[model samples]
Target: MTRRRTHLRTTPRGTLRAVTGLFLALTLVLTATGCGGDDSSAAASGDGKGTITFGYTADYSGAAALAVAEKQGLWKKTGLEPELQVFTNGPLQVQALRSGDLEFGYLGPGALWLPASGKASIVSVNMLGLADRVIARPDTGIHEPADLKGRKVAVAEGTSGEMILNLALREAGLKPDDVTKVAMDASTVVTAFSSGQVDAAATWYPLIDTIKERVPDLVEVSETKDYYPKLTFPNVFVTRPELARENPELVKKVVGVLKESGDWIAKNPEESEKITADFLGLPADRLTGSTKHVKILPSSELTRLSQDGTVGGWFDRLADIFVEMNKLPEPGKSTDYYLSDLYASAGRTDRT
Candidate 1:
């Protein structure tokens, strides 16, 4: 009988690092793609070995690339043995990172509320979620974006949903208080709409797509614009500064595997959608519809985008909205939280 060796450890952090080196070194033996290639990379913790404990939001498709790559055994292919930590949302993953329960995790604008620790930095933008839309029921007579005025709108407070809704309202010449707002998490936004708990919901993909299928009369109201110019919320992977600097090879492996995942998704869109659908237990169309709302950014682009004012702008816009909502005490600089060097070091030079 053959045995399956997983590159995961449930031990204490110190011992965990030791075992990680052993297994990671062993994993390298399994595949050269798992290690080497980068002529100037090594483990920060001394000898490179063991697996990485990666965290992400399992349900949201924006962060699905990591899960997809993990499912395809690409981590093994790259000589990365990863034990995944799944979270319900970006904030929860951020909490885990803050608590040192996770070395790295995926996040969104929901993290704007967090204070800049200067402890961790965004390694890459996993995907640009042109996410969070204002959807209205046809019965409500909310036709255009302006019709949301005086209507009951469901939004998850202190989240990207509210930010998106607020931005849409501004575009339509309305304010947050103009509409009756109901606070609900992303999960309940759909039910709130289906049960008529609210006239409309400022929600994101998967749910937005689900409401469309479940509520045929659903009126597409508004969506956040590309933040390259608009600061559209992005899903990013954050890692500890020390890990990124010391274990550059590991960082390269992570970013490289993520890029590989993007390529796989491009080549196998249908299979990718089905896997995510089955995982989310939503219809495949819900996943397919999501493509229209998000663009998965490769790590290389993240490397380029992170350098200039673009990503900083996205953070600034988020900080402004969050402060407007009184979600943050003050606006914080996005540059403080993201380290582009790691992505730059890991990015494929051959790609345009």
Candidate 2:
């Protein structure tokens, strides 16, 4: 016998209601056996008695120096035990957050939109200092941004480095099509540049440091500093909405710790550099230059940064750029989709 497909429109509302009731009954039974959980099982307390996993993506191996501040108890000062997970790039880190594997993590500002669109919601709670820099081998004959045209450049695809490259190209009166984009992971870009496989590479610090070491003739053609007043960095801390709602206090504490750590870093640059080097397992000397230039933004200034449309607006601008690049569906309203609630949860209102 063949089974007939039930048409809800053909059935009376009362009949439809009865069928829905039966379906709900079955669903409840399955849920009880497989999905139901108590508060303890669902959320862990972090009184230093239990572990709350804090995820982070830092350049542990390649750009290890850049991530030193984060890896070395910067988050812990806020009284949270963070389990730092290192990845080569932000895209993978964001993917882990969407899969529910991370409670919080750092990702490039551009990658935050997909999660903010309700597929998965995350808030940008903290902004790491701008860490991106663009470098080129002298042999490539590239002296300026305009010189990049027709040259093969290596950058991590779907990352801030790539985004910066695109923006830089436009500023130089060139389009992305004007230059060859060689997609490579950030970790490998340094080696690729050293081997002459790529004409130029755009990446963040310690990779930039490494490239400089191998190619003394290499020159920094452009940097965030040059574009700044107009350019913004790509780093931000993000967390899941559910966790932020349940543990707002803990979130505040974590932010406090990061702020304290930032102060310490500013005051004791040499010691902080050593701690960062130890944490990343890199030779302390190679990281000295990178650390000297590193700047940690203060949490107190976050309010002003948000209010003046610097921090929040940066994300909004990045979303527009993503749309123009066809990386996102369309640019959505920042108020509707961004992590304003997380900021509020942190007791912040003036996110300028």
Candidate 3:
């Protein structure tokens, strides 16, 4: 089960495949799916022990913290064997998470909404800010939000980027039908916008930074914050209820690993960037926006965010947005499913 960590080349098309190889520290890769008890809270390794299948979508930097933690030897120290099953997006990971394949998943708030509806619970928050955005060419004369009307917007289908684009339109007093929707992958947005293939596009960090670099006339039209102040993509650490309850020790340890990883990222950024870039298969310079814009909250901050209602409050807002957007049937209460209790208990949990 403990296969070596091998570096997989990122394809231009952005299709995901199961990866295998080994890193300097303890790293394992696997492609197996068998673990959940359909819509139950016991979505964890049966005895709170054994190899953990971690489902991840690494196309975005928000989920890179897991790679950082692994490279830094945090998972090994926690006595937990983490076998990461690579994924292309949250929906794919959610499918794996629901079928009892993934014990842990890292995703943005928009993606997290799907699993939260199930037995999954988001335990910690990380990488929140202006990571994703709407970019357009200045020549389009789209200087203001209102100008987006009648524009051809390239938004990746089935992604947080699209969700943000819709929200941005709603904030601009525009409807989804106001503009021409050119469905594409997030990776293609940059070329689509620059080549005039689309007048505008919704994309994330490295691409956001890239367009600014490649096209000087590029104007970042909007982001998560411009529409809704509380609406930013936060990579919430989600798990099944039982994982947080039965495996408090493991949960706390994983949180500790994340805190250590964040600390390492902040302190040794230059080196951290190199490692992350290698793992993500992007240029080190391309990752600059990620470290600059994303806030990798440590366990301490997560505890505070939980205690102060920030985590729950943010989730509540997202749920409302989804409902209003007609993406969900109804808005669900945060307390009903969110295991903010995990963050509350992470600090006091007996880790022995």
Highest TM-score scorer: 3
Off by over 4 Å in 2: 1-50, 58-96, 108-131, 139-141, 186-188, 191-199, 245-247, 278-287, 324-326, 336-352
Model 2 quality (TM-score): 0.67
State the lDDT of candidate 2 residue by residue for 1-352, as single tens digits.
Answer: 1011111122111110011122332232232222221222223464422334444432321223224345453443433344444443345555666676655565545455555454344454343435565678887778889999999998876666776677778789998889898876666777898888988887766557667778888867777666554456535565665656677665555444444555555566666656655554445653454443344555556545655656666666667766656677887766654555454345321221
Q: In candidate 1, what are the lDDT values of residues 172-236, reduced to their tens digit?
A: 89988999999865667778898888898887765665677778878878776633565777767
Runs with alpha carbons beyond 4 Å of true place in candidate 1: 1-47, 60-63, 71-78, 115-119, 139-141, 195-197, 213-215, 226-229, 245-249, 274-292, 348-352
lDDT of 3: 0.62
List model 3 lDDT by residue over 1-352, tens digit each.
2222222333323222111111211122222222332322332444434466666654434446666776766666555666665554455565666777677776655565675465577766756756667778878988766898999998775456766777777778998889998977665777787778888887766567667776777887887666433556666667666666677666766666666676666667567767765665555664454466565555666677777777777777777666655556777787766666655665321233
Top model number, lDDT: 1
The whole-model lDDT of each prediction reads 0.62, 0.54, 0.62
Candidate 3 stretches greater than 4 Å from native: 1-49, 59-63, 209-214, 225-229, 245-249, 278-289, 324-326, 348-352
Greater-lDDT candidate between 1 and 2:
1
Could you tell me every candidate's TM-score relative to the true structure? 0.73, 0.67, 0.75
**How much is 166 displaced in model 2, in angstroms?**
0.5
